[model samples]
Target: MKGIRFWAFWPVAYQPSSLQASQPPSLFGLIGRRMTKGQRRKLNRIYFMKYCSNCGQPVIHRTPPGDDRPRFCCESCGMVHYLNPKLVVGCIPEMEDRILLCRRAIEPGYGKWTLPAGYLENGESVAAGAKRETLEEARAKVEILTPYALYNICHVNQIYLMFRARLKDKRFGAGAESLEVKLFGENDIPWEEIAFRVIHATLLKYYDDRRLGRFSFHMENISPPNPNPPKTDN
Candidate 1:
């Protein structure tokens, strides 16, 4: 919050108040109402840009000449910065009747069971990233079989790509990012302790495919539940 500043233009009716100085200005009020806290937070993360990366000058949020949506633009350098979703790659390491899982040692969903997956690095292919993450987290070697499931998590701005993979051997151990690594059968999966919703969805689909004796590609959109729903006048 220290580095974040509110520099967006506001309507003449509103004045910058000292009480709300730490928070970003509300844009929804310009159209007549205030947005929910969750909505504003999501919007702020996506659009907030204090300084332009090109010229090290302050940026303004506005639509470019040809673009429909507003972006952080630099007046000094004439640069428009676009924010995009990140790709997360991972694979389910299968060894006949069992698959591998790791207990995370990190903050988000710590101590919970999850597949060997992480953010895809630059200059890395999707399949290669999946294998690298698998080896890094679970210390396991896997051969990617096929692309299994894709999840579009709009709320968090992430695209998860899960792959079906076969374990090269029984040799695997916990890596630095994992508290422990182990294999679990379909029935032995800890349903309640799964890390993220996308991972949970991938596992559910994977087991379903296994039961049918066939594997197929899957795609889904995942979002958080809305706390406030607009009401219509009767």
Candidate 2:
């Protein structure tokens, strides 16, 4: 079950660029380059499957007769396992001149602030998943106004769909996944403590739209963060 959760919710099947000769460049590996040293090591440590889930037999990592790329293939049951990217759905919950954020209780960003978001469940609509995540993470109810942004995070092999939402009421508290939930005005936002780059990008665009007195849907492709960012003389 833990393996299944990791496979579904976290990044996987990441092969570094050095190994891209035989196969295509791994978009998942790009995430490792953007992470801190410790975080990069953690992502690098997750290995591919050794056994097949279908028949509980050893699986071989090789390209089958027709497939272009390699996959986990089961000889005993003839099952082929494929790795796919995940969709992360969330909302920017807005009230009176403020937006809601939650302090994470889970790793990868434990104790840091983030918007309510999680993996989109199978068979669920993106808008419904965003609302459900808001309720689950911040204990807040919101009406999704419209999709504010769509991010293609190639590094993590994930798609982030963020919606503009209006808080139904002021009543909200921390949920099981959050240590605390609170509202923040533009000036009060903790820029350095944002949990993920994709979320940070969405927030930046949101505030930009606000300043222009209009909200527009946006789509962006994210690249790996620069490790050696230019130092500014302060």
TM-score of each: 0.82, 0.79
- Model 2 collision count: 0
In the range 64-175, model 2's lDDT, one tens digit per residue, is: 7777876767888999898788899999999979999999999989999999999999989999999999999999999999999999987767899999999999989999
The segments of candidate 2 whose C-alpha lies over 4 angstroms from its true place after superposition are 1-21, 24-47, 232-234
Candidate 2 clashes between residue pairs 3 or more apart in a chain or in different chains:
none
Which run of 10 residues does model 2 get worst, by summed lDDT?
Answer: 2-11
